[model samples]
Target: MNNSFSPRTGSPQAGSQQVGSQQVGRLYGVGVGPGDPELMTVKAIRTIAACPVVAYFCKRGTKGHARRIASDAITAEHEELPMVYPVTVELPPDHPDYGRQIEAFFDESAERIAVHLAAGRSVAALNEGDPFFYGSFMHLFLRLASRFPTEVIPGVTSMVSSASLLPRPLMLRDDVLSVIPGTLDEESLVRTLRHTDAAVVMKLGQNLPKVRRAIAAAGLADRAWYVERASMAEQRVLPFAEAPDTAPYFSQIVIPGEGKRG
Candidate 1:
């Protein structure tokens, strides 16, 4: 692999000089925020501006939400790496092929980013929410962190964004809040909902119907709120029962806690 790299020029050009005897580029896992570009943290913006190479994950034929959110910071002078996924929600998560394909994709992605780090070019991987909280950046961080100087800048999460748009607090004093994924089996979802004082169900795309059934089964459908694209231009807030049969990947259901306080 070529260890020589230049600061800019689209790709790694001719540059033999290293910063030190064995200098590697720094890695930054930057969370751009839930949906609104304004939600991005100041540090995230600064870091994206400073990085020579800006990396982000995207589906085929898409600019990606994270990349779009940080478009202002990414200038023509920066090298942009768009890591496209081999598959996304096409196959069941439990399928053996799904795991194999996704694992290979992550492996290839890590190597691609590793090339930049090896060439002494600082690369910032853009994440939509907190890097460690169900963010794709965690996969890259796991593979490249020990190999380079790394920093993770947190951003506001979708849960927080949805909560802010709600009429009541997501959780009140002494209220236990559970963050559950709508992908859970119906029985599991119902059981979890029955036990938690409050909850936020994420990943509600094709699972919306199943999640709705679970909410009803748990007897919380009346209190549940369905929020779509929270804090974005297309945001929609409605009661869970009124929600349509479908929901986007960006949508979620919020069940606020009712703990009383003086």
Candidate 2:
């Protein structure tokens, strides 16, 4: 793995040259939906099925959640590209080396994907949930979209899936929704919760206790719902107060809006 990766800003394929069927291999950001294979869109399925190259992100030695979601649809002949993160939470966010390490990883990954794109071999990067919503696929897209033809396929997000588990709507007319991650500081978390009509707090893995306190301080603890692995078979839904001390990375706290039209 070369740490110093720099590719020239020139398309390998001529504007008129075609690879498989098109001038260049277009990159497809395919959203495989939240946990469920059935929830994948028809276009996503078709695009993935048509592509020979499929890429996904995962922790080292583990299969990607996005790839697992699309496992049923994948064929034996598809070339798998596992873009494993070189470092995850191993260094402080403010550390200069942290930024450098991540940037190097993305640059290398982009260059690797660009090879397929330049050769006209279409590549589909599978993403769990909606690709644009806090997705790692966006990193590759930012580096490759301008140079290669790219398309994004939308799918069901966990926020919406969790909302469906309840009897009421996530929001009604004029209801504002705030989506926050528990990674924020306690004070900031409290402020965001207090100001929002409805809040969906994600990344509650180790932040559940803090997030719970923030919800209580913001005076929405009773109105909040703790949902884990939404839409999955092992899903669990509970009131915020009743939720366990710990939660998985996929868990979330949904604070319903007070606004409901009569």
Deviation (Å) of 141 in candidate 1: 1.3
Candidate 1, 83: how far from true, in Å?
0.2
Error of 2 at 154 (Å): 0.9
Residue 233, candidate 2: alpha-carbon lDDT: 89
Off by over 4 Å in 2: 1-22, 89-96
Per-residue lDDT over 1-262 for candidate 2, one digit per residue giving the tens place of the 0 to 100 score: 3533223122222222343465678788888888978888887888888888889998888887998899987899799999998777688767989899989999999999999888778788998899899887899989998787777777789889887787667887778899999999999999999888888999898889999999999999778999999888899999888999989877899987877564
Tens digits of lDDT, candidate 1, 1-262: 4433322212222222254587677778888889899999888888877778999999999989999999988899899999998887588877899999999999999999989888878888999978988999989988987766677788899999998888899988888999998888999999999998889999998899999999999999888999999989999999887898889878889999998453
- What value does the lDDT take at residue 9 in candidate 2? 26
Question: What is candidate 2's local distance difference test score?
Answer: 0.84
- Best candidate per TM-score, number? 1
Error of 1 at 153 (Å): 0.7
TM-score of each: 0.89, 0.88
